[model samples]
Target chain A: MLDSRVLRVFREVFDDEQLAVSDTTSARDVPDWDSLAQVKLVIALEQEFDVRFSTTEIGTWACVGDLKRALRSKLGAA
Target chain B: MSAPAEIRVSLDWGGGEPMIVRWLVADRAPVKRGQAICEIEASKATADIVSPADGILVVVIPDGDVRDQEVVGHIHAVGEALPLSAAAVERGPEPDVEGGTHVPRSLRKAAEIRTLEEGRRGSLPSTVMQQLVVGDLVDRLRDGGASLTALVILAVARALRKHRAFNASASDTGVLLHDAVRIGVALDVEPHGLRVPIVTDADTKTVAEIAGDLQILLYKYMTKTLEPDEIRGATFTLTDLSSFGVAWSVPLLVGRQAAILGLGMIRGADPRDTMLTFSLTFDHRVASGREAALFLSDVRKRISEHMVSNDSGA
Candidate 1:
């Protein structure tokens, strides 16, 4: 359920329904997801989940899985 | 009903012939302008291709190397009878646009909006015209392996160097005078649109040097390989219509720059002595017509002197 919601955020940020977030997916997977897009994504995620991400935590995210883990930690659940 | 708009590609510098990685929207899906219609993978990285107009996306060259100025697809208006094949939708092979005069509706609308915006900004434009004998100058430029356009740019740059008032834009605080002479050269980038690629510190470059710089810019322009910074920030503009058979024209000032110079076609009563008309249009609020006249006269003097000069063309 968290994965689906996170996918929605990716789709909205990139303006592409074709965007697919898998365990292996990274910034290279989504075209035009540069530093600016990353900032936008972070903002959208914070608004979506009502959670703030630290700059240190954001840099640690290498893929969707990392992002989900961080989100889970903040939510206090798997 | 509005016609279908061609989605031409403008690849960023260093990203030529990028691979069409994937289509973000399905074929014939409704798309809004500014929407990411597809994703392209360049040599260095990837970029999203945004929709140029609001309509249904029709993909052509669906997958492969799509270079600059190449039509990858079209956006047909809603409820319009869509052409089943790419051949039916395309006006022709777009690279050969010199022979085709197809102005996509979206481009036309953009031009209209731009003209309206310029009007809204408002410029008190005034013009001063002069005719110069350009036969020898043309020969000199050819000998140097440069172009008449380069020579004209060189002259305008020199004149701007002497006349600081001509190289300024009006601001609420006061007239904003530029430190360097960056000249904007207008070239007809048909099918795509008119582009004014700038040559920075133009007054400092020799005629041949400017020619070499122009050649690189021309190549970049033709290949749609121009970087974003290649086409901005001009203190003055030089628009050449000499080849188009235009005898005379008063060019409108671009943005807030104080002046724009127009070069007309080479023509004369005696075949031995051909003359080019140079017209300077200035922002009257920032510069007087007398100053504009002096600036044009200076350009004519510089061009005429260079024509008969003994030194090998600069």
Candidate 2:
């Protein structure tokens, strides 16, 4: 599920690589990462994980690990 | 493995307009891994591009009208290729659905008027805060001339004709759009945060009209008597803090709006130089990140290319 979800979000946010996901990754390490990319990533993740994120929460995430932790919390609680 | 050496790729202007290279650190003498390869200046500001995959430096456009956001050079990774060509570092297409409502020209003109009217009615009267050092803004206010904000909006409208993503938004049943892009400039007023004022059918308005209308809006906003119509009907809002030292910000998108652009402080390394920082936040449902990036990059390119120290009130 994470595989599919990550790919979907990647495609939705970046458009070039829908199949781009791995165990070790973060937007910071990506060359195309920018503020616009961050917002797009959050919006895409919210749709993929079927979870909602407050602006404040989205602002705090800097990498994929933090997003994964948030996902676990939101999805696990549900 | 031996690390790659660094290089510095420069676009010599020969006293003409400078061209931007897409590859980062593409011109180091003996480039190393993780070193900056090439640097490109879009206008007043230069982004120090880093080497993506370490490699040998090779230049492509010594001087050409290279497209914005295209990679122009590259380095060789250890046991890898030396230099990647400009065609390789392509940005992917933006995600979006095709075809929907188009904002009519008549509607757009009315919307412009209505925007100014709305701004005048509901909000507390305010003035522009953190006045940007852009000479155009200064001259317009002084001569009661055209506004930079309006010109920017018009440019967006033109871009929408081609890209369409920035101009379109999601509606419950289908897509809602304006044939023209309506842009609202967020005027920071003390005590009340930021207030947006509209500049109508910016695409069609003459530079003189924009400057004169913006002056009127500034007066009304500063006096604290903006009408409700002036603030309403904005499809997009822009908040620029280039007057302050802040470099970048991502503004929140308003309800029913497709996008909002945030601008950071403009500064130069030298006290006398002018530079601007820009950022964009768009409704993902309407335009994906790639779309927003391309649109904003276009805006940056226009400003960097057109703006000069004396290019005020024009």
Residues A1-78, candidate 2: write the lDDT tens digits: 775676677776677763465545654355455433555676667777888765346445545767777888889987
* Highest lDDT against the true fold, candidate: 1
Off by over 4 Å in 1: A1-78, B1-104, B108-116, B311-314
lDDT of 2 by residue, B1-314 (tens): 44543234333432222345354432433465566655566444565556555456655443233323343554545455554443332222533877876443342333333333333332222111121334334233223323345455555555556666656554545557767566778776554345677877766766556545565565456545566557656766777665456677756555456666666655556544444455666656566666666776677555544455235534
Q: How much TM-score does chain B earn in each model? A: 0.64, 0.49
Candidate 1 residue pairs in backbone clash: none
Tens digits of lDDT, candidate 1, B1-314: 78789887667645543567888988889999999998887766788889988989988756665545666789999999886664344345448446756665453344434432452366777788988766555554554455678777888888888899898887655788888888888877455457778888767887767776776665456556676567767788888887678988988877668788888866667655778898888878788888888888898888777777734444
Instruction: List DockQ for all candidates.
Output: 0.01, 0.01
Error of 2 at B54 (Å): 69
Worst 10 residues of 2 chain A by lDDT: A27-36
DockQ, candidate no. 2: 0.01
Q: Alpha-carbon error at B146 in model 1, in Å?
A: 1.3
